[model samples]
Every structure is written in C-alpha cells, then in structure tokens.
Target: MSAPFDLARQRFLTRCTVVSLPKPSPGAPPPSVVYYMHRDCRVQDNWAMVRASQLAREHSVPLKVFYPLFPSFGNMSSRQYSFQLAGLAAVEAELRELRVAFHLDHSSPPAAAVPAFAAAHGAIAVVTDHLPLRLLRSTNAAVAAELDALPGPVPLIQVDAANVVPVWEASGKREVGARTLRPKIGKLYGRFLTQFPPVPKMPAGSPLPPPTDWSAARAALKVAQVPDAPGLTAGTAAGMAHFRGFCETRLKKYAAVRNDPNEDAQSGMSPWVRFGQVGFQRLALDARKLGKHGEGVAAFIEEGVVRRELSDNFCFYNEEYDNLKGAAGWARESLELHNKDKREYTYTLAQFEKGETHDDLWNAAQLQLVGEGRMHGFMRMYWAKKILEWTESAEQALEWGLLLNDKYAMDGSCPNGYVGVAWSVMGTHDMGWKERDVFGKIRFMNYAGCKRKFQIEPFVSRYPPAAENCRKAGGEVALAPGVKAGKKKQKKA
Candidate 1:
C-alpha cells in the first residue's frame, strides 16, 4: 500500500525535482531521513518543515532538524555570528514547542556532520533547503554524495522555500534584468503569493531531543573573527517588533526618503531576513495587509518582495554570479576597453578594509557598514563604484567589495549582496551611463556629486572618523589629484 498524500502535499512535492538513488549495498544500514541545509529557521510558513512533517507522518518515523555550525564557511564575523546565533536560539525554542527534535552539531563541513547526525537519529531520508551560494551548494552536494555511498539507500530531498516563487518556477534561463523578470513574476504573483498554512497539526509524537544550550553556544563562538556592529537585536521576536515599527512609521515615507542616508525610512529587516527569523512571505503579506491603499506600501512591497526575489532568481540561475566574468557582454567589453586607463588613486585591500580611502564620503559609508552591519541601499552602489575607480582592476574591486560586504554587513551572504556587487562593479542588471574614465560608460558615483544632492555635513557627521590621525588631519581630503580640500573635515572628530 502507498502512503496517503493530500492535495497540498502533492502540490509542493511536484514543485521540487527529486534525485533517484542507486540500489543500496548489501548489509548496509537502511536509509534514515532528516533535514540538513539552509536555515529556514521558522516553524510556521516554511515549506521545508511542512514537507518534512508530511513525510514523517506518512512513514510513522521520528523527524528531526539538524543545523551544523561550520565556523570556516566564509568571512563570517562576530556581528554576523551573534545575529545568526541569537536567531537560531529563538528557532530552537520554537521547534521544542512544536515537539520536533532540533540538533546542533559542530563540524568543519556540514556534509560530514549532517549525515552522522542523521545516522545517529536513525533517519531514513534527508530533506534539505536549497541555497544559491557556492559554499552551501558544495556542502549540499557533498552530503548527498555521502548519503548515496552509504550502505543503504537514503533519499535526499532539496526544498526551495526561500523565495516566494521558487527559482525554477520564476525562470529556467538567466533573466536579463528587472524589466524582464518583473512582468514574468507579476503574471504568476497572485498564484504563489498566498500565505502558507501552519504546519499541519500532528498527533502527540515523541518529545524533541535535548535542546541546544544557548549560553554554551555563545561561549563557544570565535568572537575574535567576527566584526562589531550596533543597533542590531537578534531573534524572531525582535525581528517582528522591528518590522512592525517600520510598517507603522517608516513605510509611509519609504518612497520619499529611502534613498536618504540620514532618514530611517527603510525597513531595517535585512538582518532578520538574512537569518530567516522572519520569512519573506510573512513580511510581504503583512505589508500588503497594512498598506493596501497607500503608495508607500506599494513601493516598499516592490522593493522588499518583487525586486528582492528577482535577486534570488538571478543567483540561482547564474553560476558566474560571484565574478565579473558573469557580467553582460557589453559591460565586459566596456570594462576591457578602459582597462588601460590611468587611475587617479589606487588603494590596496588592507587600506580599503582599514577605511583609509581618500574620499571622506566613501569612508563614511564604509564606517556605517563596519559600525552598524549595514549601509543605506543607495550608498552601497556608490560604495562599490568608488572601489572600482580606486582599485587596480575590476576583479580586484569585486574581491574587496564582497569581502568587506560579507564580513561587515549583517545582510551579507545573500543574493542581493551579490547582485549589488555585480550591478555596481560589472554593470550586470543595469544600463550604462555617459562615458567616464576608469568606469568607462558604466554608471559612476562621486563624492562631489552626492554633496551637490544632500546635506553632506550631517550625513558625514553620523559616523565619526575611525582613526585619530585621520581625525587630526582634518579638512576634506581630495580623492583625485589637483582637487582642493575643504576647510572643514567631511566628518567630525
């Protein structure tokens, strides 16, 4: 007899492409199932959890959630670590309440840690979340291979639960830009945008395994490696509170002041979004319900939902997302033509990391990221473009930008970050502007240009200079030769 599957269950299963396993080796342990990848750390509105639960009920097997803590994954810093751990602590608490076992295993690579945990728990299959980043991709593949080679056949399921429209459903081919993807996303928006019903109530099952120790987890973290940032509170409760505050006050003016560095008009939800403390679907639905008739609501939704999801579509479909080699043909050609152009000033990776750039505005932007784990969305573009002008090559600029971004920005390690870097450094998903040196015809941003547009003094004043020497050597510093320094330092001491 086959297992009973409902309409909702069948609909979700059909969306995910399944990989068939080869026949098991004789005398091998039978496959035990579990979930291993992508921290979709929410209990409610998570397709991965829902699907995993359905399978568990059908098979009458114990289900568990496995998260591996790999410190060496990337340039993760103290700030990022604190934010992730805080959110996971909340998730662990939520999972305990749901009566599902949550396990945290420390290992160098998740592939090794996950399978071992599954085996210990007597899992028959493994369901993991799909992530577009190379590190996670390789980790998932490694785990799948390990399971394949096991003595018994273990089915591995990869779930696409991050985006509103699954990456495959959005587009099979890489989209050209927002314009191309916007319409395609719009046509199907109504279909997939519905709220995910709660994970179907299960009968009283075995109590969860021992909960992870939050205090020990904190003590064990390598604090020296992570960056320090302020104004960020971790966990789902805090995330929801922040979202509510944004919708109440900032959403009204988001359209008008989202670009202003000084105004807190933007939804400060990226940290939460990054860790899945709050799923994108929940936020989108709440925003839609709250701002049904207003332009502010519409604009915020466009950016938060439509545009942001489009980023996932880009990274998921394109392997070259991490490099300039993946840029549009015109952008690549233009950059190469200007490769020989003399740079006004060049800085090394160390100098850039230390915030030693000659441009005060640029340094201020960098300080914001280092100090707060974020910079204004508008400033991030200017931030990357300036790096292009001041570096030896576009490739070098990309490297520095991504390192600084992922290391400092709490919202780093996301498709949006990759897309932002590509758009600024290589002109992917963007159109060229008037020709300029170093940047060629690609879009350019300069300190003087920004100064002309806003109250530079106040914006600069927000972040004081990092170094005492830089502060003592006051007065506006010129980024290019022959330009005059202002009497007042761009930022206060």
Candidate 2:
C-alpha cells in the first residue's frame, strides 16, 4: 500500500509526458528507476523527483537521481556554473534527508552517459525534466534514442517542473502573445498549484551514496567564473530569502518602479529560478500565502507565469527562437525593407563588449552585465535595440546580443533570454511600433526616450562607461529629433 501523499504525487505524474517502452520478458529482474536530472535542481518542491520516487515505489525498486556535467552543456559561463553547482550541493543534502540516491558524473555528454549508465545499472525507467532550448531538446532526443536501442526496453518520462502550468498543457501550438496565453494559464494554474507533498521517506536503512565533493566539481568545470552577482547567493534557502525580501520591500512598488533601471525593485528571482533552485509555483504559492504585495502581486504573476511560460511555448514549438527567422512575417518584412538604410554609427562586437559605444547609457548597461553578471530588466530591451541600431543587419544584432546575454546574465542562455533578445531584435511576441531606419516597424527606443522613463544619469554614473577604451565612429554624419548619441542630436535617417 502506498502512502496517501505518494498517491497524490503519482496522480500528478499524469500531467507529465510519459512514454512506456516494451516491458522486460518473464523471469527478468526488477529494474531500478533513474531520474536524469537536468533543468530543475531542487529536491523539495520538485515534481519530477516526486514522480520518480512514486514509480520506484510502485515497482518496489530503487530510485536514483543522476546529473551530467558538460561545460558546453548550454554555453554557460563560469558564474552560471558556480551558481548551479552551489544550488545542487543543497539538493544533494536535501535528497539524502529524503533517502533518495543522488549521482553526478563529469561525463562528456548526457546523451551517452545517461543511457549507458541506465543500461549497465539495470534500470527500468528513466525520468527527466522538460527543456525547450534547441541544444537540450536535441540532446534529449539523442538520449531517448540511446536508451531505446538498449536490451529490452527503458521507459522515458519527461516532467515540466519548470512552469506552474506545464508548457505543453498551457498551449498546443506557439502562442501569439501574453494575452492569448494568459486566459488559459489563469484557468489552469490553480489546478496545478496545489500544495506540494513533502519528500517521501525512502526505504529504511538503504545504503546511501558517497557525499559529492562540490569543490572538486566546481574546479573541474570547463567554464571559467568571471565576477559573481554581488550579494546574491545560490540554493533554495537563498532563493527564499530573496523572495521574502521582495515581499517586504519591493512587491508593493513593483509595478511602479520595475521599469526604472535606477531602482532595484524587481523580484530578482531569475538567477535562482533559472537554475530551478526555486520553483515558479513555489514562489507563487509562498507569495500568496504571505498575503502581502497589495496590487503588485498580479503584476508579478503576469511576468513570472504568463510571460515566462510564453517564452517556453515559443521555444518548445519554434526552432528558430534565437534569431530573426522566428519573428512574425510582418517583422521580418519590416526589417528587410529597412536593411539597406544607412546607420549614423556602427560598433563592432568587440567595441560593444568593451562598453565603448557612442552612447553612455548603452555603455553603462553593458558595463553592469560585464561587471556584475546581471543587468536590470528594463535596460535589457534598450541594450538590444541599441545593438540593432549600431549593427549592420538584424542577424548580426541578434548574434551580438545573444553572445553578451548568454555570456553575462546569470540567467541567460534560457528560453526567457532567447525570447527576450528575439522580442527586442526580431519582435517575436511584440507588434511593430513606429517605423524608422534600421529598426523599421519594430519598436524604436533611444537615449532620450530612456531618460524620460528613468534616471538615466544616475544609472550611467553608477556604472561608468569605459570612455578611454571607446573609439567613437560615424560621428556628426546623421542627426534626428529626440535620440542622443553624445552632443549630436539623434535624428531621423
């Protein structure tokens, strides 16, 4: 007989995508279950882990957690890996408390490591978290094929622990925008947002795996750490602390000052949420339980659940998420129409990387990313638009923006970042704004426009631009109304 809590969890597995392979022949040994952990890194409040445990108990077999380390896993930087491994350390300990075995290997690729390990270890089923990114999606397919080619059969299950409303469940096809996706999520999240059952106690007296040497694991990473995000720590505890701090200080003012780059009023949960240290559902539930935040709570949900899931929906259904190819036909047409238009100034990727752009505000945004491994959310759109303005083509702009974003933002190389860059450069979910040179019908934002929204001078002063390193080019050739690139007035082309 299974515990009632485990029963509830087992029922929840119905929400996951499960594929059952051919069952083993008669007189075969009972196979253990393995969860090939990837995206989500938490133990408590983790759906996939709970489902894996339930399946293992159903078969009266052992359950294990397996993590594969590849530096090139997602083009992650040292800072990204540092935050991930730190949170993972907490997961290992928490799982030990639950008596679930945790296994991590510095294997070349998960496609080979995961299936090979399951086959050699006599596993019955392999469970994993859902990921929509191109590389991860392809890797998952490869792993599934590898496992299927083995002896009898190995069932593969994928759980979407990332979103409160699973990406697929939210929508069948790519969503048009938040408005299209919001209604469905609003109707569905409540069902999936039930209280998470506590981690089940594994079989008593089961021999535990050896402790993971987190230090050695960090040292072995192929990615190199740059500067860490100041004052931010990794793990579930840290994530909780940050959430509480938001509720106390910023939640009430979130809608008001969230767009102001000068104020630190955002939730700041992306780093932890990106690494799965804190579940989006968990955050939503806790924030509501606190009964605080006044009106801003709805604003947070709109961004965290609706917009976040919309990013996943875009990535999962659309293959060209990282570039202009994924843009709406209107956007693509608009950019093509303006492609030949002359830009007043252009900057090489290296120059942009050095924060040597002609605009001090743009330079400051870049400096924050390079210096602190994080950037203000509002400035992200402005940063990418400036790249589009200075670059020769939309393709180059997307490439350059992704390069910096994935390299610097603690939560980059993700669906959100990919969709964000696409939103800014390619206009993925956004509709065309006023037509202009370089940007065409896509939205146009300039220094003067940004200054009107926030305290641009304070932000610029906070992170001084590398002026000595700057080599301003294409000066005085172009001028328009409103936009400012130094003393020259930004004018219409």
Candidate 3:
C-alpha cells in the first residue's frame, strides 16, 4: 500500500474514486484525452482538469473539455440553468487560453452526448470530476458503457475535485456526526490541503469548435428565472471576488453572528461552490493565510471542510440518503410512531411551494428561497423542520421539502442538499433530543427556540410574508434586547 500522502494525492486526481475505465488498450496508439467538466466548473485549482492536462501532455495528444447539456436534469429550475450556462462562458475562455477544447453538448439526452462526440473524434481517454448523487452516478455509468463500446475502447477517468479532502479519504462509511468526522479529516487534511499547482498553460493548438451557444443552451433548459441572487454571481472570477471580500470583511465576526438571518456575515459562496465556480482548496489555503480566528476561522473550516465532506459521504454510502429511510433506525422508528399525530396545521406541497404556511417566519424563509434562490443558512434548519410540523406525515414533508428546496435553492441537487434535508428532518447525524409531540426524539427546531438564539422576526419582514400572513412594521431584528443581529452564517451545504 502507498503512504497516506501519496495515496491522498492519487485520490485527488479525479475528485471521487480515480477510475481508469475501458481497461487501457495496450499497444494502441494514444488518442486525444477528453475532460467532461461536470460539477466543478472552474479552470484554476481544479484537480480533474489539472490531471487531464497532465495526461494529455504525457501522451503528446490534444485535450478536449466537454460540458454535456441535458435539456433538464431532475427538478433543477431555469434559475439554476441560467447560472450554470453563464458560469461556463468564463470556463470556456480560460480553457481556450490553456489550449484545451471546450464543447457544450446540447443533444437531448446527456447520456449519449459525450460518448457519441468522443467516438466521432476518436478519443482515447475521458477525464471528469466527481459527484455523489445517485442520478448523476447512473448517468455516468451509462456514459461509460457507451464509451467502452465505441468504435474503439475509450477509457474514462473520474476525479474528486469538489472536496478539499476526498470523501473516501475522509471516511469509508457515513459518519455519525461532525464530531466523529472532524478529527479524522483534521488528522489528514494538512497533507491533502497543500497548494494546487496551476495547470500549466498548453501551447495554442488548433482552435476548439465554435464556442458553445450559451444563449441557446439557456433557452433549451427552459427553467424559471428567479431574480439575480444577491451577492452570489456566476463564474470563477465572481466567486473569488465574493470569497475574498468575505474573508476580508466578515471572517472575524462569523462565529458570533452567523446564525442571524439579517446579517451579511455569511460567505455566500453556495451558488458558486455548487456550480464548481470556486475550489474549496483555494478558499482554505487563503483562509489560513489570512489568520482569522475566534471560532470564526475554526468554525468555517469545520463546516466548509469536514461537515461538507460528511454530506458527500452520506450520499455516497447511503442509497436512501434523500428520504426517511436514510435516517437513523431510531429516528425512523420515532417518526413512524408519530406519523399520524395531530398537528396544529397541515399544508399541501403546493401551499408549501407558494410560501403559504401560517408561520410568518417560515413563509419568509420560503420567499427568500423563491425570490433570491437562497435562504439564510441557519434558517434552512427552521425551514425544513417547519415542513415536518405542518405537513401530513414525515414522508410527505420530506418529499415536499426536498422538492421545494431542490427546485429553488441555488445550491440544491448535490449531496450537500440531500444530506442537509435528511439531517434536518430525519436527524441523520444528530443525537436524539427530548421527545416532542410531532418530532419525537428528532432534534426539533421551532420559532421560540430560534428567538432564544437570535431575533428571527426582522428576517420575516425583510423577505415579506405571503398575503395571508402579512408582516406588520417589524423593524430591525436584535440578537438581544439592545443588540441587533450583526453577522450571518459563514456557508451552507
């Protein structure tokens, strides 16, 4: 077995499991290496792209970057599509400068998209980043099979570029909680967290096919266009700008005011990170250099590094991660015992989507997701918990909550999103709390409990409740009687 450091580096080569598919045809002439850029979208500090460039350089062959555009995947909306399409423009330009080809495949089903193109181009190998979601995994398996049968055997490689510490390296099983996973990651992160050597610029080769028609790609997806999300922009440069500003201005106050919804102390990098516009390794290296502390820096690393990877671990290992079955056996049993418990109110999925709940605070959280494509990180817990309270059953609430969240949240549809909803409703990684009417042993979050932490009413006014639950002249929210909420949470899954 290789030493941990060497193995860690090899693990980082693609993003998830470093797969060398098609079994490498020996004695076969080297063909172009193609990189199917998926979840991670940035050009700099990207391991998958970096490794692909290296392989292409070693083989003395051309490198092709492909972005397969499925008309739509799952419940992702137009707003999400708009951000993804816009972010690729920068990725295209950067790859061109590096002498790599960038192609956006818009042909109906993405499963056939890349393999068909690679076969036509007589590609020898394909490299792409990782994602732990089941749907994406199925799509990848289908694509790999196609590549293997292509006129020639074509190899496909996958790298874990999204996580600072690859999920498998972090833990082999779904961790019980952040505490259990934190030390494991802390022990090894130092070795894997070193600087990412840049992808050395390649000589200007033949130009790539005409730049992908982003406008047409946008039209093809046909998703709803939510207002441009505040502070969250689409692209590597924008992501860096937002992250740099967060480290400079808000890093110090993050630990104190992060849970307060009205504060801007959050990193606001979800949309960027979700789309791979920014690399987590880049953020960590810079954070260390800044030397910020006081729970702010420590907590940020815990969430961004350990906790974030735990979410992927959950999805990668637990096939039932998105539903109640994914919860702990204790949690599932407790919820089942109370599935028919009477509730103060019950709302349908449509009602939940329209933010028509009786709770003003809940409605405000929903509106924030609807109008801006994001909800304050702390409020996400409150939002999901409320769904469980107001809906008919835990199963219904879980499904509706996932549906609403995946449809609106900019960071929705990844392992983080699935694990978050599971954690919120199913208590996947949490200890059993005091039993309650509906929640049973599940960790319950309510409006009063949130008030004990920070004033949540001002957040309601800021987003404006639905017509049924009108907001009065509620002014600024205060953390205490005289103090106002001063910081926002650093980041979310």
Best by lDDT: 2
Question: Global lDDT of each model?
Answer: 0.73, 0.79, 0.77
- On TM-score, who's better, 1 or 3? 3
Sort the candidates on lDDT, descending order: 2, 3, 1
**lDDT, candidate 1, residue 271?**
83
lDDT of 1 by residue, 1-493 (tens): 2122222222222222342333456654443347674657777767777678777766766567888886644666777887887778777787777677788776346778876776566566788766677787777777767766654546577667777666677777888888888888788677767777566445565666677876766666664465556767888788899999988888888888788887888998888888777788778788888834388877877886677877887787887887877888889889988877899778888777767766666777888887778889988988899889989888888888888999899988788888999899999888988888888778888767776666565666566673322344343543333546556546421
Winner on lDDT between 1 and 3 is 3
Give the per-residue lDDT digits (tens) of candidate 3, residues 1-493: 1112233433322223332333446664346778888899988888888778877777767788888987776678877877888899989998888878888878657678878777765576787788888777888888888876765566677778888878778888878988888888888887788777677677666557887887777777755555555555689998899888888899888988888887888888888888999988888888887865647887787778887888888888888888887889999999999898998778777777877755667777898898888988999999998888888899988888888888898888888888888888888888789988888889887666877776665666576554245223222222334555466522211
**How many residue pairs clash in all the candidates, one count each?**
10, 5, 13
RMSD per model, one decimal: 5.2, 4.5, 5.9
Give TM-scores for every candidate, taking all chains together and pairing residue i with residue i: 0.87, 0.90, 0.89
The residue pairs found clashing in candidate 2 are: 479-491, 480-490, 480-491, 480-492, 481-491
Displacement of the residue 281 alpha carbon in candidate 3, Å: 0.9
